[model samples]
Target: MAPALKRSYQFVVDNFLKLLLIPTALAISNKYEEIMHLCNSMHFTSLHLLCASFLIIYALTLLLVSRPRPVYLVDYALFKPPRSYRVSFAGFMEHARMGRLFSEPKSVHFMMKILERSGLGEETCLPPALHYIPPTLTMAMAREEAELVIFSAMDSLFSKTGIKPKQIDILVLNCSLFSPTPSLTASVINKYKIRSNIKSFNLSGMGCSAGLISVDLARDLLQRHHNSYAVVISTEILTPNSYLGKERAMLLPNCLFRMGAAAVLLSNRSSDRRRAKYRLSHVVRTHKGADDKSYGCVSQEEDDEGNVGIKLNIDLMAVAGEALKSNITAIGPLVLPASEQLLFALSLIGRKLFNPKWKAYVPDFKEAFEHFCIHAGGRAVIDELQKNLRLTNEQVEASRMTLHRFGNTSSSSLWYELSYIESKGRMKKGDRVWQIAFGSGFKCNSAVWKCNRTIKPPAEGAWADCIDKYPVHIPEVVKL
Candidate 1:
């Protein structure tokens, strides 16, 4: 159909109920005198009261039907790679040296400096492709990495939740750098033999905050499809994204990112509430893509050498800060206590009217949430957030530790942080968790979750083997 015709059709579909109401309203108007006369007759008084009761019932039914469905986080799983894939700082540097991608001593030295300070521990795993001397960035290798991470998490999630693949009504899969033919979502459906009619979405190039973006999408879908289940798979295919260039800006991603993925099950089913871990409370995403600096702060492009990589601009931290401020400003009223909101409002007014230079009041988010899963982007990312949010060591502990254990897993890092909180037995009934992530679009997205019940330490997970060793002392600088 033509654009104008399609829009006209859509407009009619949207207003179908209103169109029906309009005809009913006109009929009621035409019969007003007859209705008034019938009301005066004794037998018609009972019928008038019956019609008024029916109208009241109809209005109540409309309200119930229009209300949004509550979205529940039924369960989630995080992928844990085998121990053989673990790469130490020395191991990573040696592999880079052997790859001959960096023939210059200065390039190798720069990577060393980044690795030492990247907040990644020696145990973080990389895909087999990256472990190669001249890393195999083949399409097949990338698919293998995706399947390894995504399917592992999915298997665990399905096993734990006992939710069959056929039961899922929606599927959302996100991989920032690796969108292939037979998209990842399509691969998942084929592998699991999910129903052909499943509403599926494949998201690419969204960056580290894309996981929450998936959650936001799934929540909206669940609200529309009542009693439905949605599964979100989040991961970064490190095999292909591994920068093999000499540019310092481009190489930062190689030294920081590692293997990780998460599968999350979301549902609007009232019966699933008893087993659900948390309920989605709010999701606020702020995008600064309109601004050139924000849009280009993190990008995937070919460098002067014609070698493609994800570049990190010097202004990334500053860009992220601005995006974060905008996101929090929008979400504060929804999540913060009334007292905090009032104080924030007063401070804004004071700053505008009286003193522009006065330090902006930062509301104590500690009072608002019991836990925080700040994205484990890197050491600098975590440090800046801790300092800016005025978060305690314990509040940022999960994030810091996740970065150490898994390195920067892109969007999946937030889920790893939340898993850390659960593994440490920090999650409790009624406790609220704030998950904040910054991504390539210079977007800062936040998801707030309210714990549905007391959470115990996991029997086995990414953190199961190493949870006790965390909150480890991370030096400001490490000497190799």
Candidate 2:
């Protein structure tokens, strides 16, 4: 009986222990699963918050560093004189004061021979103010020239752009030879009655390259002031600047330097992109004024008789060569593609470290620009540039034709060249055009522009009436 009781108690104890172990094991497993689920949910939430924070920072950075608006050339107009102002080469010499001076006949003849190679046509126009006796250089005559040429160009441009005077926020006027007390800027402001608070700049004595300098200035100003309009006037008052001295160098400007002016409008407003003609891509300026030879290469001075005129250094060509080399060096890196730049870098390295006689490569600018508007300073200038740049005849045709028609209208000549190109319908969308200028400050300036729209044949422009007759055979000399 005792053995049976002991065995039954042991069995009951074993069953109780087994029941407790089963329930506790189930509870432990359930607790472990809850803890793992809570950890996974927290980890996922943290990951999602981190992704949101990264996106917010990137969006804020973009908002803080907004892109700047591009500067564009809305449109432009150039002045054309009346028919009475047109003078043939013979007609010019027949009216010269030199014919009366017995001592000057030889010098005048020599100068005429030089003019034969000047690349000027018979149709070049002189200012009406210069028709007077003693060549009318008075302030009143100067005012007349400016009113006729500058005002006509500006007025026409205003009409074309349909822009009111009040709309112009910035005004830049450049007249190298004739700067008055009120300044050309004030004169423009006064004529148009522009706003009193307009930003006005008058650049004087900078010579033919002043036009591009003015453009560069306007571009910078537009970049700073959002959605603005600027008007730039480029002209040379030929009436007061004509040199009547016996010195041949001083007399060169008389054979050239015709009456012309150009008015350009630029904008930085986003809405203007549709109407704009060109977007200014780059402006590179280089000055060699530190070199005494270059500084004096082109200068204005008084002769022994007290008549003021510009004197060209006999070494002007050399100075121009050096200046151009420097200018293109700086400009190459800006406009050149990565491949060209790398090659140029390699060539320099080769010359510096390996071989002293390694030829420094001349970049082919034609690859970067479809059209080139070299300054119409003279035939020699054109020829030299053509040779130096290895440009084809067609590439320099616009410049030559502009010189033949306008006879070096000083700072405004480049616009006439561009107008010639546009009138021919050669300028297409995305085509790049280059304008290179040389000035009295011993400066070489370049501006690159990309056409925004396909250019059509202009209805009325500087080249409108006679563009068809041009690209004609120009002789080395037109006999009197």
Q: Highest TM-score among the candidates is held by which one?
A: 1
RMSD of 2: 20.2
Show where candidate 1 strays beyond 4 Å: 1-60
TM-score of each: 0.88, 0.87
Residue ranges of candidate 2 with Cα displaced over 4 Å: 1-66, 97-103
| lDDT tens digits, residue span 120-170, model 1 | 888999999988878898999999989999999999998999989999999
Query: For model 1, what is the alpha-carbon lDDT of residue 408?
Result: 89
| Per-residue alpha-carbon lDDT of candidate 2 for residues 202-313, written as tens digits (9 for 90 to 100) | 9999989999999999998997888899999999998777776787778878887888999999999989999999999999999999999989989999988887888988
Enumerate clash totals for all models, in the order shown: 0, 0
The candidate that achieves the highest lDDT relative to the unseen native structure: 1
Residue 264 alpha-carbon offset, candidate 2, angstroms = 0.4
